[model samples]
Target chain A: MRHARIIFDGRELDIDIDANDRITTSEGEVLDVALDSDQITWLPPVKEPGTIFALGINYADHATELAFEPPKEPLIFIKHANTLTGHKQVSYRPDGIEYQHYECELVAVIGKSGKNIKREDALDYVAGYTVCNDFAIRDYLENYYRPNLRVKSRDSLLPMGPWIVDTADIPNANALKLTTTVNGKLTQDGSTKDMIFDVPFVIEYLSKVMTLNPGDMICTGTPHGIVDCQPGDTIVCTIEDICSLETRMVSEQEYYGDKY
Target chain B: MTANTLVNSKLVCVALNDKAQLAALDATFNEAPYKKPPTQPVLYYKPRNTWSVDGAEVEWAKDFDGNDVAEMVVGASLGVVIGKETCRVSAEDALNYVAGYTIVGDFSLPEASYYRPDIKGKCLDTSAPVGPEIVAADKIANPDALTVTISVNGELKSTFELGNMERSVAELISIISRIMTLQAGEIIAVGFAGDRVAVAKGDKVEASIEGVGTLTNTLGGA
Candidate 1:
C-alpha cells in the first residue's frame, strides 16, 4: 500500500494510492481526479515531518568522487522542515552561482519511537520509504559545518515524495536501484547496496543518541554521478519500488520575483 | 514547562556569532579547509529529539569504559522566537517578526575542532533545554545589551555579554531569512561565546539572560 498527502481542489487530503495508480481516500472512496491534474498539488508524503536526518557521505563511491575518505561512522546532518517541498515542486537555483547539483536519495520514514534500537530491530521502526532530491549549492560550502544550511537547507531544495511505499513491499530496501535524470536524460545511476552504512545500521546508530520518532525521515545519502543543474532543468529522482520525485530548477529571480 | 509547547518546529542556531569566538580562531581562518573566515552566518539545526523543557533531567553521554563523560560544554544563549512567517526582511523590520525571547541551554560534550558539525557531541537527546517562560519582545529593551551567565550547582561559572555577538538578533533574522523562511514558533539561538563553562553529571546547571527567564537542568548519570 502507498500513502500520500495532497491538496486537491483546495482541500488537504490523506490519500492512498492503489497498485493501479488510482487515488482513494483513507476510507477507500476513489477520487475521479488524476495525480497530474491541475486541481491537485502533491505534498510531502509525511503530513507533519519530524526531524530530518541526512547522511553526508554514506556511499563509498560518492565519498571517493568528492575526494574524501569513507567515514568510520555515519556523517549525519539535520535539515529544517521548511527545506522540504513536494513532488513537482520548484527549487530555486541562485543566480550566478556555480555548481548546484542534485542528489537522489532513498528516504526512510520512521513509524515508531524508540531509543537504543538494535540494528536487527531497526526495520520494525520504519513505516516506509520514499525518494528525495537533496539539492546542494557547492559554491556556498564552508568547512565550518561543511555542507552548511545555506548550501543544503535553502527553501524547496529538498523535493520529496509522490508517496511512500510500505516497508513490507520492498523486501530488501538495501538492494534497490536509485537513479536521477535531468530533462529525461539519465545523469546518475547507483544502488543502495553501495551505501557504507545501510538503513539498519543508520537507524541503530542514530537511535543510540536520540529517540527516533514517527515522521522522522532519514535521507540516506546519494551516489556519485552528480552534474550541475541549470534554471530550466527538470530533475527526477527515483528509487525502485518507492517513488519518482520531480523538481524544476528556476532562477532565484524567477522564484522570488522582485520580493527579495 | 508550558513554554516547550511554543517550540513545535526546528531550532536553528548560529555558530561563531560571538566576536570572542571568532577572535580566538582568527589565526586559523586563513588555513586549509577554511581559507577565509565565515562570510555568512554559520548555521546548524537542533532536531526535535534534542528539545527538552527547563528543569528537566538530561542524561550525560557515556565513555568507552561505560563511565560518564567528565563534563559537557554549557552554551548559554538568548533564543529569539519568531511570531510569523518571516523571509527576506530588512534588519530594521526584522524585530517586527519576533514574538518573544527565552533562555536556551545548548549543552554538549566538549570538542576540540569546529571544522565539522558536531552531531555526536552536540545533538544528544535532551542536549538543548529551552525556556522557563518567554519574555515578550516588546518587554526587552535591547536584547544585544543583555548579559548571559552560567551557574553550576549555584556557583557562578561564566558570564558574558550578548553585545559581544558580531550579529545582532535582528541582523541574524534578516540574514538567515534571506535564504530560508523562519516559521512561527521556531527559535533562532543567537550564538554563544568560546568562553563556555563545563558541568559534570549530577550537577545542576542554570543559564540566565538578563531580562529573560532562567533555564535550569541537571545532568544525570546515563
Candidate 2:
C-alpha cells in the first residue's frame, strides 16, 4: 500500500493512494473528495524523524566515480531533522557556492525498534521505503570531515517522499531501479543491485551499534552520475516501487536571505 | 516530578580533537584513521530517550553480545546547556547563549573509528547518565581551566584537565551554530580528553568535574 502525508482541505492528513494513483481520505469507506496532485502540498512521509542516518559510499560505482576505494565498513553520516523538506518543495542553494549537486537515493524507514538485530531479522524491522534527494553544497565540502555537516545538513537540502510503499509490497528491494532527471533530461541512472551494502546488512550493522527507532530513517547511498544543479532547475528523483520526489532549486536570496 | 526525571534534556556528544586521547587511540589501532586530529567537531546526537539520571538503574540491552550482562567503556565529559536560541553566533558572544554546565557519563560498547559514528555503540537507552546538578555557567570562573576524573569502585582510573581540549566551549558553539540552530535546553557535551576505563556488572562508575558535581551510576545486568 502507498501512503502520503499531505496538506488537504487546510489540514495535514495522511492519505492513502489507490491503484489508480488517486488520493483518498484514509477513513472508512471511500470519501467523496478525490484530490489531484496539484491541489495539495506534500510533506515528508515521516514527521520529526528521530535520527537521519545516511550512507556515504554504499555504491561501488559511486565510490569509483569519486575515486575512493570501496570502504571495508559502511561509511555513514548524520543529517539533522532540520534538513528535511517535502516533495515539490524548494531546496535552497546558499550564496557563494560554486558546486551543488543532487543525489538520488532510496530511503529505508524503520518500523519496529530493535537493537543488535540479526541479518535474518533485519527486514522485519523495516516499515517501508521511500525516495530522497540528498542534496549537497560542494563548495563547503572540507576533507576534515569529508562531506561535513555544513556540506550535507543544510536546511531544506533534503527533499524526500511523495509516498511510502510498504515493505510487504516491495518484496525485492535490491532489484528496484533508481533514476534522476534534471529539468527534462535524464542525468543519472542506477539500480539498487549496485548497493555495496544491501538493506538487511545495513540494518543489522546499524542495529548492533544503536537502537533503530520507529521513525528513524536510513538513506541508502546514491549512485554515480551525479551532476551540478542550479537555481530554477527542477530535479525529479524516482525509485521503482517506492515514490518520486520533485524538488526545485532556488537561490537563498530568493527564499531566505543572501547572508544565510 | 521525581528527581530521577531530570535527565530528559537533549544530549550532544562531540568526538575527537583531544591530543593525548587521540594519541592513545591512534597507537592502539593498526592503521590511524587520521594522521592529524580532525579539524572540525565530529558530533553525534544522544536523543532524550537515552537520558538517565543519578540513582537510576540502567539495563544492558538484551541483544548486547547475546549475554544477560555486558561491559561498557565509561567516558565522562562536561556538558553545556544552551540558555537561548543561538544561530551564527561568534565565539566572542557564544558564552552568552550558555545557561549552565553539568557532567555527563557517556557509556558505550567499545568500538573503533569515529569516522562512521556507530549508532548501536553510542546510543543505547539509559546509556548516557547526566547530572547531579546544573552549575550556572557564570559560576564557572574559567570553564577551560577545570579537571575531570573518573573512578571505578572508588579506584582512580584517569584524570584529565579541560585545558587540553583542542577547541574551547565558545569555539564549539560558534562552529556548531554556523551549521544548525542550537535551541534552548539542548546540551553540547565537550568530548572526553583522557583514557577511558571499563565497568561491568556490579561496578560503580563515577565521573566528577572540578566545579560541577559528580555523576555516578552503578553498572549491572537487568
Candidate 3:
C-alpha cells in the first residue's frame, strides 16, 4: 500500500498515497489527528534511522565541471540530526556565510540490516526510498574545514520528506529525475543516471563499513547545476517516485526570532 | 555482576559527580554500518569543555565573569563526545565502545567562543558537568523509544523521543565510523529535538529517560 503523512486543512494522518506520496484521504473524513500547521512537526517516514549520511562529489559530471576527479571511493559525511527538516520547513542561513545552495538527490532508505551484503543482493536490503536536499552552507567550500560542524550540520540545514516509497515501486532509483527550484525559479536540474556510482553500489559500498538501519537515510550525490541562494528564497526539491521537500531560506534574525 | 545484553544496543554513560546523573543514547557503529571506513580512523575530540548535560539547572550572568546577559540554558543538551578508537562497528556492535553517558550543564557566552578562535564555539572547563551514573548498554532496549525532556525550574521546555531524530544511534555510529575511526569510550550525542531555552538562578533542571534514570542539577550561576 502507498503510505504518506499529510497535513490537510488542519489534520495530519498516515494515509495511503499514490505514486506521489501525497495525502490520499478523501475530503471531510476528518483525519484522526489534528495539529496546527505552525505547530505540526514532520519526521522522515523511516523510523529511528541509524544514520544520516551523504556522498560528496559523487557525480562524474559534477566532478568534471569543478575540475576534480571523483574519489576512488564514495566520500561520505554526516549531517547531524540537528540539521534535518521535513517538507514545509525552514532551513537556517549561517551567521557568517554569504553563499548557500540546495542539492536535490535520491535518498536510499535501508530496510533490512546486514553487513558485507554482496552487490547482487544489495537491492534486497533496501526497504523504501525518500527525497532529501543536501541544504549546504557553501560558505566554507574554499576553506579547508571539516564537514562535521561546518559545511554540514548547521541548524535545520537538510530538508527531507514528504514520504518514503517502498524500493520495489522504483524499478530503478538510479534512473530518476532530481530537480530543485528556489523562489519558483529552476535552480538545479539533474538525474540519478549521471551518478558515477548508483544506489546498489552505494549500498554495497556503505554496508562493508556499517549496517544500515531500516530508517537510516543516504543521499546519492547531487548532479551538476547547483545555484546559490540567500535568505527569503523558497526551495522546492523533488525526486521522481519519492516526495518533495519544501523550505524557506531564513536569516539568523528570522530563525532566532519568534519562530525559534 | 554480569548482565545479559543485545549486540545492537550500545549504552554510553557519563559520570562526573557525587550523584552522577546518567542518560543512555545510541551510537551509530564502529564498522561501516553503511559502507566502509573512509581512511585513518578518527578519534575526534569533544573535551569535557564541550560537554553539557540535559536537564541540569543553569543560571544567567552577563558572562562567566559578569557582563550583560539575556538568559541561560536550563535543562538542555549542549555537546557530544566522539569516541577515540572504534572501527567499522554496527548498531549491534555499539555497546562496547562506550565510556558511558553523563548529565552536565553548559554555560558559555557566545563571546566565550570568540576568546578562543582555535576551537569551535564549545569546549569550556565547567562548560560540561556529566554523570549521575553509568547505565550498562544491555539495560536499555530501544534508545529511540526513550523519552528525553528538559525542564527549567519545574517548567517543561521540550519533550521529544530519540525516535524523533532523523538518524538513529546505530546509524550514526555506522556513518561516523565510515568517515573517521571510533575508539572505545567515545560518544556521539543524537542531537536534541527542539530549540534550547534559558533558565534563571535558583532554577532546577531535570532530564529524565525511561528505563535509564533522571538527572537533576541546580543553577549555580554562570
TM-score of chain A of each: 0.97, 0.95, 0.85
Better candidate by DockQ, 1 or 3 = 1
A146 Cα displacement, candidate 1 (Å): 1.0
Tens-digit per-residue lDDT, B10-92, candidate 3: 22211111111111111211222313212211212233223434334333333322343555553233123333455556767
Off by over 4 Å in 2: A25-39, A138-147, A252-259, B1-10, B19-37, B47-49, B57-71, B109-112, B133-142
TM-score of 3: 0.54
- Per-residue C-alpha lDDT of model 1 across residues B52-155, encoded as one tens digit per residue: 88889877876434467777888888999999999889999999999999987888888676777778787788888889888999999888899888899999
Relative to the unseen true structure, what is the C-alpha lDDT of residue A45 in candidate 1, on a scale of 0 to 100?
A: 89
Q: What is the lDDT of residue A18 in candidate 1?
A: 81
A1-260 per-residue lDDT for model 1 (tens digits):
89999988777899998888899987767899876787779898898798888999889999999999999988888887788999998999988788999999999999989987889999999999999989989998888888788888888898899899999999998899999999999999999999999889999888767778999999999998999999999999988888888899998988887775
Predicted structure with the largest TM-score when compared to the true one: 1
- Per-residue lDDT over A160-239 for candidate 2, one digit per residue giving the tens place of the 0 to 100 score: 99888888999889998999999989998999999999889888887765667888888999999899998999999999
Top candidate when judged by lDDT against the true structure = 1
For B1-222, candidate 2 gives per-residue lDDT tens digits of 123644333466777747677667654433444445455777777664568887666556544366553557878888888898777789999999999999888777775555455665676778787888889998997777888899988999978788888788889989988777677877888878556677777778888998798888888683
| Cα misplacement distance, residue B125 of candidate 1 (Å) | 1.3
Between prediction 1 and prediction 3, which has the larger lDDT? 1
C-alpha lDDT of all candidate models, in order: 0.87, 0.79, 0.56
